[model samples]
Target: MSQSKSGCKNAQAEFSRFAKPLVDEALAHAAQGEPSPDDFHKLRVALRRLRTLIWAWRPLLGRKFADLERAYLKRPAAAAGEARDWDIAISLLGDEQTKPDTERLQTARRDARARASSTLAAADLKHALREMLRRVNRELNTSPRRTPIKCLARERVRAARRALRKRMRRAQRANRGDYAPWHEVRKGAKRLRYLLEFFQPVLRRRESRRVKSLRRLQDRFGALNDAVATEHLLGQHREVFADAATADAALAALKRERKRRRRAARELLG
Candidate 1:
């Protein structure tokens, strides 16, 4: 089960050994026309875990398979995104606020649920899953997994550090008034954070500490994004507004919150 013994190619060997069974299991379930919600949920989980596993091993594999990985996995993740978004919205608003926005939120929740259901209904996902599993298994079968853990870990660390440096530079170059550039800077920071998190086991303690700081930066940006989404959602449900003054005030408050969060994100990241 452990591929760490395979000197230089530990990550690739480990990923294949660890993830291949999960992929195979998911594909087999899909092929059997499994209709249970729990089955689909398991499939989705398998896909996500495989994707994360590959991402952590990407440096060893190079960019050649990046497109293939995205093609097969990203679509399913997108199919699940709406539901996840609604879940996030609910979690953010808390139970107390759920009443006031129940009708509208319910509609969004239903749409997400529908997407999840429809995604499983589509045979392409099943076929795609099987096909991807076949390809990955084929590659692993032929390849010796020659890359050692040390080499793989070094590559991941180098790449993550490079990404962090690049994002910090971007933040330095971003203009105070240019929210777009700052947003991009935040995105870069997030990538570094994710990379570090994915490879945490291989990273040094100081590197992990840096990863935590970068994660805090990402969290700040995520909060700002949530504020923006909240503002947009509130505006879109204008028909539910009881009074003109209240609606106007709500809109204004939304905008103010977004503005404040953005500022806070920038300060925290800086």
Candidate 2:
């Protein structure tokens, strides 16, 4: 991987070059009726990976590609999310005692498990995902080649800074203390990290280290987001469980876990 004046451009090109074959093969396997679960899973992983690469390189290509890629990805990622949530919810059943509202939570978990299972079975999620992958591949191949890397980098940075400043000001108004400003700071940090990572040619290891620290901060926020989202999903299906006790317990456990996560984020930000 020789460095080019346009590392972001090269990175995007490499991602496209490698992703096409992987997606094509995965789609073929899924269409074969006897698609192995492993193969299907591989396809999903490939899509996620490619999407991540696109995210990291979004400064190079601008928001259009980002929007288009995300549009194709939303459904597939949602299907995967449902399956993932079910897996997590079901595991909670076995660990009910460790959680605060074990009895109630278990009930909720059971209900969630049943619903998730039914949804997974009825939905041709793999088929839809395969078709979506096919479409994405076609789109990528035909997408425009030129990327205004320098110009886009300047704009992306400016936009990121503006958004961060706006958010920080709001947070200050709300009196969120340190957490508010920290949250806004991390957003700016992430945009910088992504931009630098994509534009690797001019980026140095010292710069990479700084960006890595910012990424750690971003990760802390991401964890909080995940827990909140997951808890809501589990809570929404609480009525389906036969045991209210288990559901309540699970919800309580999730609350504590969420709190713990928030504290961790605070520590990192601080």
Candidate 3:
């Protein structure tokens, strides 16, 4: 679908419209007892998109309000993040060898889920999100300066692309097996992907190829990162393990997977 030609005002309104329902949906899902992984994932994704929009329009919103909104979102996002990490760990490393770590993760996951539910249920959260949208609308209406959203989108996309390229270059130049460098590249890739998706309506047809390439890179990086995260989690909670050997085995398997994923990512980059 084509974006409205009107410009930033229309874009702000469109973003507000898209964001409200996602917040409502997230709140509703959180209200349910033991929200599913899918529900948490959806909530995380919704908030991410909202944050991305704010970031893309930082100049329009002004830094103070943008920082305020982002800070307000951090708690809920972290809650969801904690739950998500456990969810991913359990899903990927649930074999007998990882049973000890899995159990610990499950305990942590339950705590995270409870925190997420409580945070979502807070009346202040809904009120703040509503107020944020209202403030953004008000700011957009009152601001004297105006620019076409397409122009802004193009500028942001180019900037994101440049950032991704720089990160990729750094990753390529550094030790290929270094998880830290690759993880940084993954984050850049994710940001670029989000930007592209947000601006797809204004992008040209040929951009689809770029989108696909970014997606593939993101997937590869995500796989490697997930393994690294799981291994880290297991290592951090070693004292909680019922069977240290089991945890060790799981960590070994994760390291092997990380290597494989790193190889795949390198090949894709080339």
Candidate 4:
């Protein structure tokens, strides 16, 4: 058809080629009855990358298919996320100081892993994803949009960076102890980083410095997010601890860590 349509189709084909192997690998990893924590992590990351690409191309794909694809991807990603959170918690807490808490986290990890495995094994999920991809390709082929693939990629990257910068500024202006703003900033940084990664091939040399900065920003915010999640998880299961005093001490330490991380992130923003 037209030049823009051709560009869009080419871009879609490129993304599908890049994503298919990753999806297959994730599915294979999840098919195992007892996949390693790394397996789930890899699957979740693969899904995230795919979702980011879809989001960047949402305008061409339309709202209906984009929403459907997002929903399909979200289920397994969330399941994997639960398992991953527990894995991180278990690793960070260690076995020495909180034996009872450690045991409880281990049990939670097992349950999350089982849930993730079950979700991944569902045949409907695979069918839905396959159908969605088919629909996406069809739409890209027929759509009247004339925007070049590189133009679309650049627009998305710019938007992601602007959103992240705005959020970071708000977070920096907020009180240091305000966890909500920092968490929002963390989400923004994550979205921006993923978008940058998806557009890396299209905008390679120009994005090198931006990619490095985004990574550092994401890491700082991710550390803060993990600390906050740990504190909340420990609070939720406070009764499981052998000594309430120990639980309190652990939570206090997490809070201190969170504060330290928040400060570090803010310093970066400034």
TM-score of each: 0.69, 0.57, 0.85, 0.86
Better-scoring candidate (TM-score), 3 or 4: 4
Full-model lDDT for every candidate = 0.61, 0.55, 0.74, 0.73
Off by over 4 Å in 1: 1-9, 17-52, 59-62, 87-101, 123-131, 140-145, 171-191, 233-247
> Order the candidates by TM-score, highest first — what do you get?
4, 3, 1, 2
Q: Which ten residues in a row have the lowest lDDT in candidate 2?
A: 30-39
Candidate with top TM-score is 4
Order the candidate numbers by lDDT, best to worst: 3, 4, 1, 2
lDDT of 2 by residue, 1-270 (tens): 444455445333454554556556545543444333343455555555556445545555457866676556544544545545544554444463534344654565455435544544455546655564455445455656754344444455456556655664554454432344545555555656665555444444465566677678678765655566667776787754556786677778777777777777667633
Candidate 4's error at 170, in angstroms?
Answer: 2.5
Better of 1 and 4 by TM-score: 4
Q: After TM-score superposition, what is the CA distance of residue 12 in candidate 2 from its true location, in Å?
A: 8.3
Compared to the true structure, candidate 3 yields what TM-score?
0.85
Query: Tens digits of per-residue lDDT for model 4 on 86-158?
Result: 7776655654665446576567778878887887776455666666567777777777645566677778888
Give per-residue lDDT, candidate 2, residue 60.
50
lDDT of 2: 0.55
Model 3: clashing residue pairs?
A: none
Instruction: Name the regions of candidate 4 deviating beyond 4 angstroms.
Output: 1-13, 99-102, 175-177
